[model samples]
Target: MNILPLIVLFPLLGALILAFNPRLPNRLAALVGVGSIGLSALVMVWLNWLFYLGDGGGFTQTLWQWVTVGDFRMGFTLYLDGLSLTMISVITGVGFLIHLFASWYMEKDLEGAPGYARFFAYMNLFVFSMLLLVLGDNLLLLYLGWEGVGLCSYLLIGYYYQSEYNAWCAFKAFIVTRIGDVFLAIGLFLLFTRFGTLDIQQLLQQAPQVWQEGDLMAEVAALMLLGGALGKSAQLPLHTWLADAMAGPTPVSALIHAATMVTAGVYLIARTHTIFELAPFTLSLVALIGLLTLLVAGFTALAQTDIKRVLAYSTMSQIGYMFLALGVQAWDVAIFHLMIHAFFKALLFLTSGSVIIACHHEQNIFKMGGLWRSLKLPYACFLIGGAALSALPLVTAGFYSKDEILWLTFDHGYSLLWLGALLGALLTSIYTFRMIFIVFHGREQIHPHAGRGIAHHLPLLALALLSTFVGGMIHPPLANVLPAGPEGQYGHLIRVLTEVLAAVVALVGVGIAAALFLGRRRLIGNLMEAKEGDRLRRFFYSGFAFDWLYERITVRPFLFIARLHRRDWVNSLVNMWPALALGLNDLLLGTQNGRLRWYAAVMTGGAVSMLFLLLLF
Candidate 1:
């Protein structure tokens, strides 16, 4: 009956059970993970139904007082509102499906090593952390979730830690996120000290009052909080971690990039929309950064030939859309877009995973062609996912959500943002279809050894079907939670226009691929021939040296300083005083003798001096 505890406790219980029973059969362990997640998902669905029944009031369920200080109190509490409830549904619902898919995908991994239980353990723990993030009633609790997810990410990314690069990538992801978390933690402390409370609802109510009273201090506090959201959400400057996060398995990439972590930034902005409302300058910067990041990432996506890398760049670009919405104060529309993006993007990534596994680990598009005939299920899934992403019309999920965001940006006189977003949409369509055409439409450049089986195809089929129709069946209008837009009678017109634009974009993208790589053997050959051209190709392949720039600017400098510290010079000055103090202590001890004769001589000399002073007085 108590839904809040059940939501967090169930996965926690699963983690406990799996951690202890390490010897359980792989299938049985997977079943436990899947079944536990499924139960949690059902509970989430039930809660969603109940929440939907309520008029508009939000709900809070306080479990107990977690800690108490002299005059401060924090609790183990969960807040269920329209925003958090939507997040819960996505985390547990889609999360369960991903777990089910993983049961099959990870089986091969278990054949040589018994990591099945361990994998499930990580998944279950990841779900619990995500729920905490969404359901937390206070900033401290939210930070707990934030750190928890980062820990799970590190563990899962380095799941196959035998590889040096996997381990390095995992560490990079962990440390980079921790950099953002530090700012987030400081912001939380400032909120508590200034407001005397960590409760989110109370802060929202008080922030505006503090602002109206000319509280410069409070505004600075809010800006500090924005820094955290920017980093977590992968806004412009701190966005490099996400691109490197793709170094994990495809499933990890899907869960983190498409469905969960990347959305954290948007959720943070929405959760603290009150703060943004007060700082108009910060809001504008948020929008501008989103616009710039989207354009940059979209161009990079166009240049990528690796299937997963393309999806990774696309994710950065799409999250920019959410930030754009946030900048314009369309918090609800941003959230709506987030929901739809999760469904389709996850669909795309998982389907892409299936194709990779079928191809025996081949990743380059040039190395894959004529896959449509052999990989019918994956092909179908890709098409559906691509359609939704392009926002091709007829009331698909992405169309409704993305169209709303674009319209909101335009309505707010952010014509430039609208234009940038529209171009992003077009580029998204082109690159997606480019991968589709070159991989499935052109010549059969099959690998010498390719494996095809039912295990890989089933998940792809299920996700494909969901991708196509799930967008239409969910809640309608989504107006209750998001800001209310004007209700119009132009439903048919909207649908027609959206469909036409989406189709044109999709066709142009597909047509370009056909023209360049389809039947022109000489063109394709010559393009691949020039060794000098290879250097140019490599530049595109390397993300235009953005990764290198980050390393030189941030990563290398960080490591260099770390090495400098180990050299015992940068910090040796700090030790100088302590070392001098110790030497003085040793020197002072040598002057004191424990013998009675030495003590007597010193006492007699002091007494003689005292007598001389007394005579003078």
Candidate 2:
């Protein structure tokens, strides 16, 4: 009945086995990599069935007490609930599909057999770390998983360690996330100090009793947690690393962008909603940050030439919607969006991977043209994923989830926030269709072929189907399972009108993209070559110059200080004592000459001097 440990252990076991057995053949490694996640997914399915049949309340399974000092105790435990179950379902299910896709994607790594096995090893480890992050019962264990994902991301992102650019991107992802981890650690310490327990359920219960609404301590703690979420979720200022993260393999991009790294922040906020609720100011700040991030990332996506970078920014923007939902006290809606985003985003990235492979690993969209006939499966998959991403009316799952967030924003009286979200929706549709048109509409640039075998196409088909229809099926169940938020007292007519309005905005965006990219490609190209247009492109393309600004403000100053202290004055000062001792030794060397007469003379002189002193006394 306690199948929770198996969910995490399966992937961890596979990672260890693959890692230690470096001699594994490519075939065997692929089997192990894909099998491990598949088994985990199966176990999760079984657990879901059991959870539904049993009591609806959450359950915690403690493996052992991991740390103890006097009254304090921390356990290595797994927590199961509707929220975590949803997360693990996505992690294991979608993660398995990614693993399967990677088995094919990395089949012919330039590094050959060793590199192939190593890639799967890191992927399995990433799944394990992500599983632990969602299922952790205590803050300490969650932090362990938090840092674990960060490590796995660094390893996987730098999969091609030979490339300096890849290595730099990996380091950027690691270092930036670590900055957020520090805040999360501090928040954990604060929580433990306040309540003397790291157990999440107990902390949630105690938080309300000890801290009143808007309390300063509560606000600070909430903000620290928000900082962690910001970094992990790729929100606004901490978001630069994600676009660069496309330096990794396509599957790595899919995993990070869709199921694992970026979604962590949304989960963190949902899990700790109680803390955020206590800090009303922090909650408002969350909404504000989400609004800014969604719009900023949406525009950045428009300017990206690389296929994967566009999806990367889209992931950031989608996660922003989740944050916005949380900000408005729409907890269930946030999780709903997270789930829907995972499906379509993963599909989009995987489809892009197929395109990259078909085009001989070319990622620049401009370099790619009409492939609809040559690569039918990828084209279809891309269309479905793009439609879902654009929230195209009632046909795609994103429409339900995204429209709910937009409606809630307005219903809650945050009209400006709602307007920003509407603008973001329009932008999302534009970029989604824009990329679609650029890649699939123009004349064929190269003959394309679908990736070989069922491993490649099966996941894409499955995810594509989910992206189109999963929203309607999951909504009612998710509503039943998640904690409910306030529903505005709007009539059926008003609700219908809101949905209509959202759909129209999305359609208008798509229409504009179609007309500009599909109908008037030459004119757009000419405009792109214009001086003002070039300047505008560069601004958005560089993530609104945040990276450059950070370089000037943070990176350059730090580098200068490092160079200034390269000689290390403190080290020089420390060496001075030893240098003085050596000098004194040299000065005394003549007195220690290996001669008995010299020693006797020195002794006699000392004795004479002592007698002279006695006479004088």
Candidate 3:
């Protein structure tokens, strides 16, 4: 009777239908795909209302017992609380908007019914997996959803199967993330082995009793989980696959990379806060990774020429902030920023998609200019999203959530991390506006055509408003779900000063961008032409050459080993038994090749042998 299960079911059922009917008409396909997510969004709304109407506590639904073994049991169960509610609301709500926009965005990109239907099918499946991920009561179910999203990401990212480059990108994303998934799986195994159950609520309850605050197993488990988070969220070292992933369609970028899938890391960390709290060393490591990743990604974004790649690196940096919050124990604020980030980041990606389409598929920011008058909707949307992204003062939603993270970092005695965060913020502002200025403020390079219809306009306008201070007003209910953020001991003056500094840094970064990028400045050209500057540009443009380094270290070495084996030694081992069996089979075939005289002679010999054996016995 509960509507909670329906929130996940609707999209799944839609995916099944669309998958079975690939030849379904485009309009009808759109109806099924968009309508399914729309339905889920509606159910989320109804559930949110019911949650508030009730005692405002957690809810769990056990559909049935799924599996049982010696001293272990699992079930088809779902859990709901303030944390999951926010996640699902974002998944279904923002997800529906993305799907609606995709219906329009994909219209010209894809032709015929099969293409449309297939695209919708993948989208629906992804939505289903994402909902299941946030709703599952147990780690197994959550892992299922987690892997499901990864699979769909590959399929959707390589939707243009005709392009070999796109296919390889999908493969790269898949393989890179699989390494992280293996880490997550190992962590799950470690927890289950120690605690004897994968039920998340039970794990949280029992971990404290079973393990000391600094237990080795706990730290190792936490570390393994962090590995998974880094890969999924595109943090440093494991972050090479994300920018190449931009080869996919823009909707795929918005949905999988920006809005929903990338945030899974933050969700995983927050969901398992109790375990992380036990491992202080690992907890500090989380913050350090975040700090390093943000700075790396921030510098990388500044050098990008492609519009989408800049956004891609920016995503990595923002997620770094989320991880920073997680490390510093601002769990609620991290989730808060995640929610706000989904709003503005989705807006920016979608608007960029619009720009790409308008310019006849041109994505280079350097190639675009002075189209603000022609494409006013996208221009305005970009400005709003960019401001929010840069955390520009009180006017934008990012200011509220991000400022909290900065304050908490400083308030909790991590002043060095706070300083690093400020520098990252400055970089964020400059790179973000650098793209804005170069793309929209310079002379028009090509004629443009703006997208029309409700799908294009509604999602952008809605997200634009949310990117403002208005979206930050809807507070997440985390008082009971997460530990309270640390109290600011440094009186009112210090807190005010922290906020003021962050805002000023953001503004100053924007001013610097304007000075350099506006009017085709001589300074930037001179700098780019310099030997060191050009080298740095090339380095950053290649994402610090992490991909190239990985190629030499992981890919080439693997290929070399494969080549030396000449069919693989492991394959030889497996083939030995089959070869032996075939040889015996060939020997038997030789005996069967008998002439009449040969048959008679064989019979006589068999008789003589039988008689001689009997006599000897």
Best candidate (score: TM-score)? 3
- Tens-digit per-residue lDDT, 66-147, candidate 3: 8788767899999999999999999998999999999999995764434899999999999999989989999999999999
Query: Lowest-lDDT window of 10 residues in candidate 1?
Result: 476-485
User: TM-score of every model?
Assistant: 0.85, 0.92, 0.93
Candidate 1 stretches with Cα past 4 Å from truth are 213-219, 447-459, 476-503, 521-540, 558-617
Worst 10 residues of 2 by lDDT: 475-484
Please give the ranking of all candidate structures by TM-score, highest first, separated by commas. 3, 2, 1
- Cα lDDT of model 1 by residue, 1-617, tens digit: 36768989889989888989878898789888989988999898888777667775667888999989987888999988788888988888778777877776677534558778888888899899989998999988988888888898888888888889889888887877777788888888888877899898999889887675335665666667767876677767777777777777778778876788778878887887777677777778888888888877877787687898888888888899888888887777888788788888888888777777778777787799989888876787788888777676653567777777776776677778877888887777777777788787767888533334554555565556656657645652235444553343345665466456645665576566566656654664687578866666667667667778888988799898988777586478888899999999999797596888888988999999999999999
What TM-score does prediction 2 earn? 0.92
Which of the two candidates, 2 or 3, achieves a greater lDDT against the reference? 3
Off by over 4 Å in 2: 109-113, 476-482, 487-489, 575-617
Clashing pairs in 1: none
Residue 165 of model 2, lDDT score: 93
**C-alpha lDDT (0 to 100) for residue 568 of candidate 1:** 84
Candidate 1: Cα lDDT at 273? 76
RMSD of each: 8.0, 5.9, 4.9
Residue-wise C-alpha lDDT for candidate 2, range 26-105, written one tens digit per residue: 88998999999999999999998898897757888889989988877778989888888999988998999999998888
